[model samples]
Target chain A: MVAKELVLKAELRKKLGSKHSAKVRQSGKIPAVVYGHGQEPEMLSLDEHDFVEGLHHGHRLFDVQFEGKTEKLLVKDIQYDHLGKKIIHTDLIRVDLTERVEVEAPLIFKGTPAGSHEGGLLEEHLDHLEIECTVTEIPEAIDVSVKHLGIGDSIHARDIKLPDGIKLITDPDALLISCRLPAVTAAAPAEEAAEEGEEPTSPEVITERKPKEGEEESEK
Target chain B: MALMPKRVKYRKSQRGKMRGNATRTNYVAFGEFGLQSLETKWVTGRQIEAGRVAASHFLERVGRVYIRIFPHKSITKKPLETRMGKGKAEVEQWVACVRPGTVMFEIGGVAENVAKRALARVAHKMPVKCRFVSRRHTIG
Candidate 1:
C-alpha cells in the first residue's frame, strides 16, 4: 500500500551552489529541486527534520506547500554525503495522484529459507526490482517469502507476486535470491593449483632458483 | 590466504590518489547490512583477511560475509637499511584502493543486531573509518 500523504512547508531558494547548500543544511533544511512536465526546475529548501521523518516513515509522495500553493511531488532521488550518513540534496518531480510511473521498489525477503536449515547458504543477489505502477499504488516495499525454498531452489523476478496494479519491469530472468550448498573449503586451493597445472608455491616470488650442481651431475 | 589477483599486468603499482566518493557499488547490494568506508585508503590484503576472519568468527559461521574489495594493486617496499634505491622497491604487498562511500564488506543471512556486531568487528580490523548501512528504502 502507498504511504500516507505528508504535507511539508517549503520556501523558494534564491542562492544556489555548494556554498548555499551548505548554509541551507546548517539551517536545518535540505536543499532540493523540483522539476517535471517540461517545467523549469525550481530550487527549494525543506525542513530536514520533517523530510527525514517522512522518509523514515516510508512517505514518498508529499504535498509541498510553497508560496500559497500546494504541489504534489514525488521523491525522484536523494544524494547522501560522502559517508552515506547525511542527506546532501534531494530531487523531487511533479506527479499527479493517478499518474503511472516507474520506480525502484525494495524487495524484502521474509522468513528464513528451509534450505538454510539444511546447511545451505542463503544469498540475495538483488535487493530491489524495477516496477511500474500508479502513483497512489506504490508500495512501501515488496515482500518475498523464502520460507519454502529448499536446497538448489531459487526465486527469479518473474516468480514474484507483485501487488495489484503493479507490473514488474526488471528482467524476468534475473535471479533475486537462492539457497545453495556452501562452497567446499578444504583442498579448494590445491584443486585450483592442479587445474592451473602449477606447483603449489607463492606467486609473489619472481626470482628463479638455480639448479644444484649435484642435480645437474645426476641429470648428466 | 587473502584475496589477490592471480595475475596482474604490472607486478608493482604506484600509490595512486583516491579522489571523491565511490560512484559505483557504493550501496548495500548483495547483503542486508554493510560496512561503508568513510575515508579513502589502501586496504591491504592482510587487513581484508583479518576483517573477514573477525566478522566470520563473530558470526560463528551462522551467516555469510562477503568481501567487496580485492587487493589487486601491489605495493612495494625497500629494505630497511638500504639507502636511496637505484630502482623502485620490490613488491611487498597488495591493497585495494577504497574511496569514501564504498561498501567494503557485507554480512547476510543474519539478524540485524548480529549483522551490526559482526560488521563492527570488521570495522575494528579496517584502516578506514566505517559505518553500518542497510538497503535504502524506496517506493515506486
Candidate 2:
C-alpha cells in the first residue's frame, strides 16, 4: 500500500559545491529537491532543523507547514553525509489520503521471552517490512508475542499480525525467530563421556550380531 | 508585470562577514536530540526476527529523535588522520563542516539510546564491517 504523502514548500535548487551550498546553509535553509509525479526535479530548500525533525518523527511521512495548511508526504530518497551518515538531500512523494498507498512498516516484538528463564537463546531476524494499503490503514507498528516460546521455536513472516484490510507483502516462510543451542566445552574428561555413551550403545551391539551356532557358546 | 515575490521569501541576518576562509580549529555545535517513529508490516514470504521486531516496536512506540554524533575523535583512541576511511569531503562553508573527517547524522527519530542500539544491531548483523562515530550527547 502507498503511504499518505505530504505537500511540500521549498525555494531554489542548490548545486553541489562549497561556496554555493554554503550560502544556502548560512540562511538556516538546507539544500533539498522535490520531484515526483511527472514533475521536473525542482531544486529546493528547507529549514535544517525542521527537515531533521521530520526525519526523526515522520521518517516516511510528515506534514509540511507550507503556504497555509500543512501538506503530508512520504520520504522517498535521502542522501546522507555519506554511508550511514547525516541526511543531506531528501526526496518526498506527495500523497492523497483517499488513495491506497504502498509503504514499509517496521516489525515489533511484544513481551519478554518465556524461554529466557529456561536459558534458551532467542534471536530476532527481520526488522522493517513493506506493505501496500490505505494510508489510514497504516499501522504505527506490528507486534508479535514471544510468550512461552522455547528452544527450537520459530516464527515466519506470515505469522506477524496484520490489521483488517492490511496485507502482508513479505515472504511468509522467512525465518523470524530461532532458538540456538548452547556451545559445549571440551574440558570434560573423555572417559566420563564415553562411559555415559557405552550403556546406550550396549543394546545396539546385541542386535547387530546374533551369535553363530558354534560361536554362541564362546560369545556367551 | 513583475513577479510577486515568488511566494516564499528568506533573508539572512545582517551581521554577516566576508567569504574568505579562516585558519580554523575543528569544532561543531549540534542541536537538541529528537526521536521519530519507525514501523514495518509482515509480508507473506519474509523472515521476521523477534528482536528486530521488538526493536522496531520500541522505536515506533517511543519515537525517533536526533542526537548529535560529532567530535567523533574524542571518544575513540584512534586519531582522525589514522582512521579516515574512503573519500570524505569537508564543506568550505557552513559551521557544521569544521572537522575534516567528522560525519554527522539525524538518527531517525527513535529514542537516542534506542536508535544507537538499533544501529548497533545492524552493524553486527551486516555481512561487512561498519562503524559509527559519536562525541557529545545529552537528552532534552
Candidate 3:
C-alpha cells in the first residue's frame, strides 16, 4: 500500500498559446493526462524525475496528487518515447476502492520445469489476463509453477489462483503458458551442404581503403 | 481485442434452479462502505420518472445506493436528437449507482448484460437510464 502526497504545481490551466507546452517541457517537467470515472480529463505537469520514480514502484495501486487534492488513480496506460528512454504520457483511472475494477495482470513463471532442462521451449499464449477485482486486492503478478510441466503441458487462465475479491475476466480455457519441443531448423545443414558443393579452389581476394589526410568532418 | 470470440453463455434454465441453492448471499463485505457524488442533473419529473421508478424497484430488491448524471458532451457535427425533439429521448448522459459489494447487475426478462441496457432503457420510456448493481454480473 502506498500513501498519497500532494504535488505542489504552479502551472494552472491557461488558454492555449504558441507552443507553450513545448516551452514548458523545455523546463524539464512532463505533462500528463488524468481522467476516467465520470470526470473531465485534466492536464497536469509533474517533475520528470519524480514522476518516473512513482511509476517505477507501481505494484498494486498508487495515487496521483495534484494541486491540493489527491485522488486514487490506477495506472491505466503508460506511453514511451521513440528511444524508449522517457515516459511521454500516462493515463490514470479513478478507482473505487471497494468496487471491482478490471485489470490485466502479468503472468510470472515460477520453479524450473522438467521440460525446461530437457530443452523444451516455454511459450506463453497470453501476456496478461483481464480480471475484475477490488482495487486494493489487485495482485502484483499471477504466478504459475512450471516445475511439473511436461513437454506438452499448458496452464490456462482459470487455473491461476486469484484473491477472494478478484474475478477472472479472461476466457476460462484460454491458454496462459505452454511447454513445447524446441523448434529445429533445416536451413543450417542445407547451407553447410551448399558450401561444400561450391568450394573456393583459390584464395579469396580482400580489399581495404584508407581515407586521405584532411578529410575529417568538423562538429559545432 | 483481448475479448475471446467464444460466447460466455448464462443459461436461464440452470440459473432458475441454481437460484434456490443460492438462498444464502455469499458476498463478503466490501470494505467500510462509503459514497462519493461526482455530479447530478435535474430533469422533468414527467417522462424521466419511470427510470427512477424502475431503478428504485431494483434498488428495493437490492439495497442502498448512490446516483449521478451529467450532460453528455458532443464533439460531432451530427446531433442524435435531430429527428425527434429533446423531449423524445433526452439521453442526457450515463448514470450509475455502485453498491461496491456484490453487485449482480441484471435486466430484462433474461439476465443479459443489463448494465449498458439498463442505462439505455431508462431514457427509452423516461429521460433516464439507471444502473442496478448487486454483487456480481450473474447471480446464483
Candidate 4:
C-alpha cells in the first residue's frame, strides 16, 4: 500500500549547537535538519508528539510546511537516545515524488522455517535490503516466506521476488536469511579459543598439585 | 568454582573502554534474542556466571544461551591494612568493560516469551539496566 503523505507544520530554527538543540528539546520540540536536491540544509524544529505520531502512521514521505512553502521530504534518518526510548534528532531529505530513491526496506519473514521445528536455528543475516523505487512505489516492508526453509538452506538477495518497479540495490549474492543448526556447542569452543588466542587452560590445572614426598612421608 | 583464565599474560591490566560495535565474534550477530545493556559498567565474572545460571535455569536448558562479553580484563586491589607505595596491588578479579547498547547476552532456539522471561532473570543479576531485544525488533 502506498503511504499517505503526511503534512507537518515546522518552524525554521535560527539558533544552532548542542545547547540550542537541548533548549528545543526541553520545549517539547525536536531539532531536525532538512537537505537534498542541491538545496542548502535548513535547520528546523517540529512538535515531538506530532513527529512521533507521524512515524507511527508508517509514512516516510512528508509534505513539510514552513515559511509559506511546502517541501516534499523523506524521512531519511532518526537518531534516538541511547536507551532507544526517545527520539533525539532527525534528518530529512527533499525528494521528488516521481524520481526513484534508494532506501533500505525492512525484510519481514512470514513463516517459521521447517528447520526450526527440527532443532535447527533460523537466522536472519540481513534485516533490510537496499532498493531503488519511486516514492509512491516504496514498500513499507518486504516479506520473505521461510516456511520452506530447511536446515542448511539459505535465501540470498537475488532470490527474492520484489514488487513491480522495485529494484534491488544490494549485492545479489548477499545472504539474507538461513536455516542451520545452533552453533552453541559446535562452534563456540573453537571461536572462543581463537579469540582468546590460546587454549583456556582449566584453572584446576594451575591450582592443583600433588603433595611433596617429604610432606607425604611425614603425614604417613 | 567460576569461569576464569587459568593463566594470564599479565597479572593485571588497565581497564579499557568498551567502544565501537561488537564485531569480534559471531556471538552478537546470530542470536535470535538478546539482552542489550542501557548503561556502561564493568561486569564481573561472577555476575556473568550468575546471569548465566539464572537464564539457563529459567529456560530449563531448552535453548542455547550465548555470552557475548567476557571478563578478560583483570582488576587489582591492595590487601586490607596494606600501606601505599608498594607498587601496584595484586590481581583481584576479572571484569568485562561494557558500554551502553552492548549486547550482554543472547538466546536462540526458544520461543520469544521464553527468551524474554529468561533474559529478565538474567537482567536481575546484572549491575546495569538492560532490555530484551529480539531479532525482528532489531533488523530495521
Model 2 misplaced regions, further than 4 Å: A1-9, A14-28, A65-71, A83-85, A183-220, B1-140
- What tens-digit string does per-residue lDDT give for candidate 4 at A1-220? 6555988999999999999999999999999999999989999998899988877767788899999999998888887765455788999999998989888888877888898788777766788899999988877788899899999999999999998899999999999888887654543454466567884443333444669999999999
lDDT for each residue of candidate 1 in A85-178, tens digit (9 for 90 to 100): 7898999999998899899988888998899888888888888899899888878888999999999999999999987899989999999999
- Model 3, A81-143: lDDT tens digits are 422245655566777777678877766567766786666655655657788887777666667
Give the alpha carbon lDDT tens digit for every residue of B102-128 in model 2.
222223322346666765553343222
Over 4 Å off in model 1, which ranges?
A185-220, B57-62, B138-140
Better of 1 and 2 by TM-score: 1
Model 1 lDDT tens row, B19-105: 888987688877789999988899998899789878877877676887889987888899899999599998778899999899999
What local lDDT score does residue A76 receive in model 3, on the 0 to 100 scale?
75
DockQ ranking of the models: 1, 4, 2, 3
lDDT of 2 by residue, A1-220 (tens): 3443434456655476667776887787777655556656655677777677654553456666543545555566665442223555667665666767766676666665676556555565555566778756776566778775776787788877787887777787888665444333231243355456742111112224455898977778
Ranking by TM-score: 1, 4, 3, 2
Q: Score the docking of each candidate (DockQ).
A: 0.35, 0.02, 0.01, 0.23
Native contacts retained by candidate 4: 0.19
DockQ, candidate 1, vs. native dimer: 0.35
| Model 3: per-residue Cα lDDT over B1-140, one tens digit each | 00011222211111111111111112212311111111122233223334534543443322222223221121112265576543333222222222212112222111224334443444454322323332211100
Interface RMSD of 1: 5.3
Output the lDDT of residue A148, model 3.
90
Candidate 3 Cα lDDT to native: 0.47
Relative to the true structure, how large is the alpha-carbon lDDT of every model?
A: 0.86, 0.46, 0.47, 0.80
Once model 4 is optimally superposed onto the true structure by TM-score, how far is the C-alpha of residue A167 displaced, in angstroms?
A: 0.3
